[model samples]
Target chain A: MRAATASVAAEVEDLRRRYGAREALAGVSFRVARGEIFGLLGPNGSGKTTLFKILATLLPATGGRVRLLGLDPAREARAIRRRLGVVFQHPGLDPKLTVLENLRHHGHLFGMRGRALAGRALALLGGLGLDDRAHERVETLSGGLARRVELAKALLPRPELLVLDEPSTGLDPGARRGFVAHLDRLRREDGVTVLLTTHLLEEAERCDRVGILDQGRLVALDTPGALKERVGGDVVVVHARDPEALRAGMRNKLGREPALVDGLLRLEHPRAPELVREVMEAFEDEVIAVSFGKPTIEDVFIRLTGRRLREGGPA
Target chain B: MMGLVLPVTTLWWREVVRFGRQRSRVVGAVAQPLVFWLLLGGGLSASFRPPGAPPGTGYLEYFYPGIIALVLLFTAIFATIATVEDRRTGFLQGVLVAPVGPWGIVLGQALGGTTLAVLQGGLFLLLAPALGLAVSPASVAAVLGVMVLVAFGLTGLGLAIAWRMDSTQGFHAIMNLILFPMWLLSGAFFPASGLPAWLEWAMRVNPMTYGVAALRHTLYLEVPVAAGAVPPLGPSLAVMGAFAVLAYLAAVRAAGRKAS
Candidate 1:
């Protein structure tokens, strides 16, 4: 039964959600395999939040079908809620409650009690490296530490699927790494399927599979490596004094125009080294700087959406 | 049934714990009403005597039950205000996603508010002797029971409003526009008799009037016959009970809705 159910932990088929006339999720569809970390990557207003709320059973979709753990969210939301753990982007812990109290509250919400509940709460705290701070109120804890408590509370019920929204939003680099390591361990040992939505490219890159969303549509869905590979070669960027003039010159000489994004000349070429050298030498006076490197997830997003992942890129 | 009970009790416990942690709220909800009672009841006692009371009845004594009702009202408002903050802090989101139904969640919150209101009101009841009013154990128990029912209804009314409010400012607007008027016209501040027809009618229709009347009737449990304008104990209790149920259902319905 585990293997059979493990085939698909969550599935969305042509899921569409709208707010009146405005479409938030336009026919978005994807399947999350059990034990895999699947991420929905998008920029602001890209509808990832709308999708997250729908999956969390907080918002009803205007149209389409969503199934979590083989149960429809519309009809069997309570059943889905029982097996699903959610970590919201904002702080969900009650500032007045201690870390242990928050975990205990979460346990009781799921009908766990007595020594069983107490044992589960303590075990989760210990596992999350929060044993020493369990008695401290969440208001007194640091941002990263509070986030860990939130995760521990979510895990109190031992959910089969853990859904997080921008899980590493406020964490520093070290804390972010620690949080990711915990997720990795959970996936490996407990076979828990993790679903998250994020705008950070690095965060998305670490996921097992990522679905890129732009303006309410999923543009590209694949492993980070595969998405980057789709760009197929080095990414060459040219910051010239006159990008239009240089583009014209490059078009005449190289017989191709580089994609102009955020006022920079960008090109994905199989042999970018020769291309960069030739462009620099050919337009030495016009070119200020030339750079080329392997494609990153940001480049993949740019290649697909024709926009920078982060709005308002540097000139 | 056990599954539903856990979430309700857990939510209820959180409400009480949160209220206990905020000492300022205790002073605001309990002490503030006491000051209101002392100032208003004292100021009015020398100038006017309540109509239709026994020969020696003063404004202070007439207003005592009203003050208890005010304590319950104030505590309910303070407790339900947390619902707005819960939404802001994303705590409500966590509860919404839990496996429990809206009925359990709202019941927990309503009961939590009711507990705080009753505790504060009961604390105020301790001052009853200082005012030269004597009460038996039976009257005291009846007063507490009346307080619980009244607080539950008031808290439910507050929840029905707070759940749909996006900001505390909006809630304050509602408190001023609706809640304050409800309290004032409920015969808590003054006697309902000898008023304009419309004002008298407002008090007659206001559900909280029955709550205050019930407190008065139960507080004077020793009185062989009721004074003027105090509704019968049985009918007042019935109204309070019906109001509690309807208000609680409204709160549950509000919880089940998508926030606009």
Candidate 2:
């Protein structure tokens, strides 16, 4: 079991890509183990898309090295593509073709044919719960259903590695969950390795490992539980009038400064409940509400980069 | 090799299937050229007599082969517009990552466009007898052969242009600014013999002019015309064949380069 899990499915060492004066990926590095579901999490303009394009072989890296299935992407891209399946952030299905037609065409591109191709496509549709609508045009299907067809098409060649760019972009919560579950099933049943990029924290949480990117740099890389523990304690958010005054008063009294964010005093402590109670009682006039909970992936991001996971509004 | 042939056939099949689904494209491809033939041919028949002609040929008969060439040009340009659409909708992204090279993708599109152009041009040939032109088996076969050559070259040119354009509007503007004028000056609307020296020289040098001249030569193979009237068949075919190969190479080169 140890030997089986130690094999690397994909690797990137100090990979970099630049567009004119702007650096999209700056010396990023990571390795995905066989059958692992690795996720790259970052908000818009964070270079995750640029990195995804390079891995897909649609774009070339300006510096460093990348290996897919132990094959160099710059030199052996065709060989790597033979063993890799890709799903883009936008829909790749031909809207005019039926779901089965789309899958069959993809199989043909991989040199698949006749009974074997048809059976593989139908079986994948059945697995994805889309067999009943196989004959329907892709344009007639819902976004979630079309996404399932795209997944079925990619799996037709039985690829060793599957790369998806922002796989859950437009999917609803339920659909996203269903999509992730399908990836899990592929990993368990076929031993296919998955590398997906997304800005959704919940989506990253479901992966075996997550790489958090911020402005072309990876800020953190670890299992969700391990990364969350970096905060070391519960997160406490204190809502009050004149948050700066309350923050100053708390610093003078408690000898620890709480971060002022969006008109709230936030802090991390081992004894969050006791601290919340003390703050409520001492500054009862200034305090509006005090809430505390175990640190989440969002808190982990906030701790590493003094900014929220999303800006302007919630993800 | 399976690596090259399979993707080309599949991509080609996709273009044909998509063209079938969009009924408007079918009607527009056939109808637009038919309208041009009728309006222009009818208005000019009385005053126009192609230079060095057999004396009694009307403009309707004179412009018949030119209209067929126009049909091919239209079909090829419209068919290759899918490249821009495929890029815009992210469909081409999927194909680009496949094991196939850019040659496979461009060839598939060029062949798909050729098939559509030949199919439509053949249908237009049915109207030849109406203009007192003979419809013989030899002429029909030869005309289709010429149609395939001309269509393939035109489609490759279209793909070469379409692959570099980010928007369909830009493609339209380029086609208008470049291709439409080339078609008008390709000896399609007027005989090259009677034009001003410079304009006639332009017609002689235009690759599309050779394609139109070849179609005219093939359409009248059964009933021969004057020597040096339409361009010689051997040189016309050679020019068209070279254009097809060059244009296809250009398209593959465009697709091979990274967009960044």
Candidate 3:
């Protein structure tokens, strides 16, 4: 049973959730393999939170099944809860409590106790670089340190499947790198399956596999490598004063069909380093700036959807 | 039983821990009621003659038990109404996902409030001697028991409301509209028997009325019953106990519901 459960950390089947007249999660489904970091990638209002809540067993779906650690969230929430560690998107620490006190109470809530519980809490805090700050109140900590404490609390239980919501929200670049690397270490050492939701493509890039959501539906699901490869070679983007004319001229004159997104001409070419000048010269006066490079997860989102992955966020 | 007791003890200890850290809240909750009792009781004692008063009983003496109930109410509100803050700050979200069930959570919260109310009420109990009120070991025990029930019922009511509230400002509005009215008409400030018919009925139905009546009865246990005694001791104790149990069950049920 352990081996069988080890292969699939979480499985979802056509999960649907409705909030009054609006459908939040409309027939979403995916499976996360054991020890893999799976990311649910979408911008705000794309049902990412709705999906996260359903998986957390905080909300019941209007339809379909959600199983985490081989247990149904609806039927076996308590059993799943014992094995599932969740870090919410918002700050969940008690501002008045010290870091160790917060973890002690959290452990008690999960039926943990005594010297062993203390041992585990200290171990987690030590691993997260919060050992020295153990006696400090959570409200006094910086955003990055507080986030690390939250992770320590979530990791204290040694959950088989760990779920986080926008785990990189308040962390600086270096802290974000360390956080993911810590999660990667958890996967390697403990075979813990990790899932996180993010609106930023860069954050999604850290996941082993990503499920792209749009308008309450799963648009795509694949490895980051596979998702980018779908765009093929390099993507050349041309910012032009007359984007429509530039796009038309690229297709009509150069026999090149480039997708127009956010008023920019986007062409996925096998040899974009050489094709950059061709597209720029083709619309010499019309083009303001031309760039070509390895296709990012953003380019894949544009190739798949006709819109940018995020409105505004750091790359 | 450790499953239930451990969570309850830890949560109750958490409330005490949090209370110790917040000095302003302690002063507000403990001292605010003392000021209210002194000013209100002093001003009203003159020419305030309700039926069933021992011929020479002053309003301050009469309102003494009522003020203890008020202190319990304040402490109950102080301790448990922060559930809205915890919810707003997202800490409650973390608790909800834990392995503990809703019933355990509710019990922990309700008991936490009860402990603080009992403690604060106990502090006021010490002042009873200065007020010329008698205190035997028996009366002290009796008051603590009744205060526990009264505090538990009040805190559970707060829990039922707080678990659903997303903001503390909204909670304060509701507290003023609902909780204050309940305390005011519970025969805390006045006598129930001497009231007009409809007002009498409202007082009789208010659960805190039974709590205050029980406290008064226990404090005045050695004394003879006056003509205008409220609800008698037996019925008051029964009603208050039932209220505590019923309110707790309601809070647990409310917490189990899916919050948006």
Candidate 4:
């Protein structure tokens, strides 16, 4: 038998990508341990796709070293791909093909055939609660069902590592929860290492660890809880329609400068309920809107980089 | 060995399934070539004739094999749009991320396109008898062999072009500029003779010219062993075989490029 290798699912060192003159990924380094669900959290243009492509062996990095499942992606690409299951951000399923047909083709490409392949496919469909829709065309299925099929196809070969790019892009809230629960069960039972890229805070929150990438560089890397903890305790965003007087008055009186992003003041404090009251009393006429809660990955983004996460469509 | 074979078979089967699902592709692939052959052949038969033609061979009869070659080229080229569609629809990304080698990917797609071209071209050849030509079984067999070679070459050329293109519009530009002119210069529309010196040289050197010549030579097997106007059997097959090899290599090289 081949001896077991290192437990690292993925290892990247000083990864960089350049398109013409713009650097897409600049010196990003991180490691995902075996059997861990790691999320590469970033907004649009944060180089998540570039890094994902490199790790998946679909695109080469301009400068850096990457290893997937303990094998160099450049030299041992075939070996890495053999053990890697990838779910792309775009729809990879052939819409004209039936769910079972797509899975069959995917299995055959991975050298899975005969009765064994059929049995495994059937099991995956049953496990994913799609046994009845096996013969249905992928185009006819709902977004959630199609996503389930994509997941089924990825797990068909029992891959050691599963890489998903924005797995919850088109999913509804209920479907997204089910998808997360399915991944959780997979981790609990099969111990499959997963690496996913997403811009959603809730999705990143479920990850065992996350690496926050901002503007082609890794800004922070840690557990979502620990990263949130870096923002003190509670998070508050106070929107104000004011001239320069509001900020200057608050700076002189409170002595705590709040981050003004997009004409809004964002600050973190342990006693956010009391702070919200005090800020309201101090600037009642100047305030436009206000909201407060515990810091999420979005707040961590702001706390670390004085910029909002820019809640927008999928990256 | 099974690893390579399995992926190739799966990809090839996918082409067949996709082609079958799209009924319009079948109708369009068969209909467009027939219309072109009839319109061009009928209009030119009144006046156009080669310098030294085979007796009883009018423009329609002369342009018969060229029609088959056109069917192969057009259908083969159009079928390769699946690559661009695969990229747009995100199917090719999955295949690219698979463990399969570049050779397997190229061979699977090439053979899939070749099979569709030959089958589509074979359907067009049934009209040979209706066009007043007696196509014997031997001649049909010979034409089938030539179709396989040209189909493989044309499909490889199409794959090389389509793999690099990110959009169907860019692919359309290439088809018009490169593919159509290639067919036009392949002695398909007119014979290589009775042309200017430079034009004649272009026809002689064109690889598809040999493809057209090969098909024409095979279709005349029922005729006298010695044929006129058409190039010799030896050089045409040699050129086609070389073209198939070189085009396939070029396609594999394109597919294997790291940063595209």
Regions of candidate 1 where Cα sits further than 4 Å from its true position? A1-6, A313-315, B224-227
Candidate 3: misplaced stretches above 4 Å?
A1-6, A312-315, B226-228
Instruction: Give the docking tier of candidate 1.
Output: medium
lDDT of 3 by residue, A40-118 (tens): 9987888999899888889988988888888878788988888989999999999999999999999998888999999
For candidate 4 chain A, the 10 contiguous residues with the lowest summed lDDT are: A306-315
TM-scores of the candidates are 0.97, 0.96, 0.96, 0.96
* Docking outcome class, model 4: medium
Model 4 misplaced stretches (Cα beyond 4 Å): A1-5, A311-315, B224-227, B258-260
Give one digit per residue, the lDDT tens place, for model 4 in A1-315.
Answer: 123347777888999899999999999999888889999999888999988888778887899888788788778888888899999888899999999999999998899998999999999999999999999999999988999999999899899999999999999988999998899899889989999999888899999999999999999999988998898888888878873667787788777678877667777889899888988888899888889988888888877777767753321
Q: Write down the lDDT of every candidate, Cα atoms only.
A: 0.88, 0.88, 0.86, 0.86
Lowest summed lDDT across 10 adjacent residues in model 3 chain A is found at A306-315
Superposed by TM-score, candidate 3 places the C-alpha of residue A304 at a distance from the truth, in angstroms, of 1.7
Q: Whose DockQ is greatest here?
A: 4
Q: What tens-digit string does per-residue lDDT give for candidate 1 at A1-315?
A: 667655898988899998889999999999999999999999899999999998888888887888899888878888899999999999999999999899889889998899999898888889888889989999999999999999998888999999999999999988988898899999999999999999887788889999999999999999999999999699999998989988998899878779888888999889998888888778889988888899988899999988898878542
Off by over 4 Å in 2: A1-6, A239-245, A261-264, A282-291, B226-228, B258-260
lDDT string, candidate 4, B226-260, tens digits: 24476787899999999998888888888887323
Error of 2 at A296 (Å): 1.9
Model 3 Cα lDDT, one tens digit per residue, B19-72: 888999889888998999899999998878757766877788888888999998
